[model samples]
Target: MPERFPGCITRVRGISAGHFTDTRRPTGCSVVIARPGAVGGVDVRGAAPGTRETDLLAPANTVSVVHAVLLSGGSAWGLDAAGGVMRWLHGQGLGLDAGSPETPARVPIVPAAVLFDLHVGADPARQPPVCPDAAAGYAACQASLERGALAEGNVGAGAGATVGKMFGMGCAMKGGIGAASVTLDGVTVGALVAVNALGDVRDAQGRLLAGARTADGAALRDTARALLAGEPPAALLAGRNTTIGVIATDAALDKAGACRLATAGHDGLARAINPVHTCADGDTLFALATGQAPAPGPGLNVLAALAAEAVARACVNAVRAAASVQAGALWLPACAQELPVAP
Candidate 1:
């Protein structure tokens, strides 16, 4: 059967996403484009983070909307992808109205972040480290703009991604992109996450799905357990992971409410991924509202709860959809590859 696109995020009118992958380079990006602009806010919880245009979303900032959000690999170098997104939106005449006087103009507003995936993927001596740049970002935007057809796993920002590096790549498992959404009384909430963390992925039932493996390549081990064990080798891996995502909703909301939703989304991360929000992990979540659907009578809290659940589900979906690959000398099996994890 063909792959199914998770349509949760796209369910929100005016919101669309595109995934562009460069298989040869083995690195890419995910672009979430909002029609014109959508009310937006973000929360960065991880100690080490790489982001751009987030200041514009501050509660006191003048810009209340964002045209797009970019999540990419290549650490800070991947931030360049937002430039391409801006260029694309500009050509479509979408952006903040800054030009005055005679000529009508619009300056696109794009917020973006990055995750580090250079530790492996290709042989260092042969392929050279790969990262997404302006050209690559522009190309992804050009591929599609309409809603639906959401891509997950080994693609976009999740490409060249890995997780559970607590014991280094040898025992680390593969991580990728995932998405989920929910609808309540006409209000729709959804999430899309790039699962690259220094922890393990778990299902709602608290079952260990994927993460660090036994040294002999046997069973999966809880990342936190390995660290608590105080093994001498556990100190080898430091500050080399991140999990970034976007929370989308159709309900009307202001920047403050959006920020709250972003903050609440982290609770889902904590439940789904063990040992999150670490100094080595740049776990950030962005929330956007299109203002088309009616806000619940109880306010944004209702939507926020839905958003949290959606994020937790998306994290698991990311790992399940991931495909195993040979990253240079490192080999990351599929979430179900030769392992006893249920897919």
Candidate 2:
């Protein structure tokens, strides 16, 4: 039997995850495959987001389900990776039926989101910036089928991710991908987040986990505190930062309920990251329901609460699992590397 990934999204029935990491550059894509199809809903809270096929996820849309979701690096350019996922699903003969004559075959429904990690391996003077593409997406799908456990941290979409950029890359710390799940009765809700935010990350108890550092680069400089103190950001890049992820559940839910779950996920983001959902951050979350378990007695309310907890834990895990990175002149440290050891 394949090894199980404890607390990962794959713990939910009908869900599987795979990733493709670029060797030449710190960039890649992550694929969440639900080949059997599942109800999908999305909520984009970030002012500037890079996404594809999100409109169909709205409650009013006609599409009933989604086969997969893509989270990738390379900003808007990464959206192309979804095409590769479509090709893989098509090869497997898995997709929604297209009733039209021009396209009679099954068409896979893939919704995607991208975060900015274009600077990790960028050498503009020597070569063009490398980004995730269709091939990367296809490779990710293949890996998903072969791997039983999902790898977290500096891999896949979050390969080049970073956090606490208020003071710029000089003080920013490495961020990556993390997954977690919450089970109540028979229902399971899981979250997978790629942390690349423009703000500081904190735990549920409000303790600073990672964020910008002082000029001396010794300790964390709370972004919210600095902002409230009327200190201006030393470096601000608009539309260059985002935190993207997906929430999955085994409970039954319609499009509207899924959307509500997606919204509830943002509460998790807020709980873990300070100064989120800003003009510069594109925080987007997608929710999927496999409908394998009965709906909770308290309806989506209970499920939403569980989702929030999972998301928060996933976000925290992302930073904690990340390892320090040295890409060119940028030497971003991971939270684990910077945090002081308990005495």
Candidate 3:
């Protein structure tokens, strides 16, 4: 792990409490807000995405200090899980009018994102249309703030996530959430990603890490190549696929800047994943500022590139942390190497 940035850097600590799998085997992951009054913004790239409270990230939105963030399974229906987060935040009096002694106290906002995972072949009862355990994961996020240590891999939102949908669910590989950070000229930029792309996972050097084979381990052409050859890209569906992520920095930025940064961060996803942001892919990125430090002096372009690199690193890490499932297993290339740092 890297050292925390200077000047009141935002400290992140989260965990996966309990997990809920839908009839489609999508897993729910949740995290709590360890710090109060954290500033944030969001960018949505996927045309067919399912989300909750994203409007709060807009510049016109007045609320701040989100109590928690939820990433889960259950497709669009998973949006219901946020109700539990509201319930928890309400109890702590952590919302808008948090300190007031009124019957209707304000609380921290809770924003959530979801991925598709209905084809993993888990028990039907386990793979219901909705998941309440996702809310339990939010409670766990709060508990993890008091408790030390964060758990990763096939837990939380990544619990039931899959990648390389070229052949549909039958050939997708297990993928989950991943995080990474980098320091540029003394400023820190970190990224968190839920790696549920419709394309194959690759290393920084563009080597295929997984998703180019049949379940039986037979080698297949690259998803992009297959698509260009007029083969049916089974994974490229308009409403069924998406990859989501968040970028956090200490720099002071308004919502518009945050949105621009989020757009730039998508370059990282393009670099790390093949055939990204296709008509069938719903890719989104969120940029957040804790407002605890000044922006780097090198200029916004430098910061943008740094943010993009952090996004790429986060995408790679997410793929690396994904656990193998029965339908399709994730495989990192033995010969894969990291990209060389720019001179």
The local lDDT score (0 to 100) that residue 232 gets in candidate 1 is 44
The reply for model 3, stretches above 4 Å from the true place, is: 1-26, 32-34, 64-67, 98-104, 125-127, 130-134, 146-149, 214-216, 235-237, 294-298, 327-343
TM-score of decoy 2: 0.94
lDDT per residue as tens, model 3, 62-163: 764445566666567666777776676667666667454556557667777777655554454643544535355455455544543344446666666666
Give the candidate number with the greatest lDDT. 2
Ranking by lDDT: 2, 1, 3
Candidate 2 Cα misplacement greater than 4 A, ranges = 1-6, 100-103, 126-128, 294-298, 340-343
Model 2 lDDT per residue over 1-343, tens place = 1122359888888899999999988889999988498999999999999999999999999997999999999998899999999999999888999868875878999999999998776878744468899999999999998756688889999999999888777878888999999998888999999999999888767778788877667778788888888978875667688999999998888999999999999999999999899888899999999987654534689999989999999998888878889999888888876553221
Q: What is the C-alpha lDDT of each candidate?
A: 0.82, 0.88, 0.61
Could you tell me every candidate's TM-score relative to the true structure?
0.93, 0.94, 0.80
- For residues 43-101, could you state the per-residue lDDT of candidate 1 as single tens digits? 99998888998888888988898888999988888888889989998998889998777
lDDT for model 2, please: 0.88
Superposition TM-score, candidate 3 onto the true structure: 0.80
Flag regions of model 1 displaced more than 4 Å: 1-7, 123-128, 146-148, 236-239, 294-298, 338-343
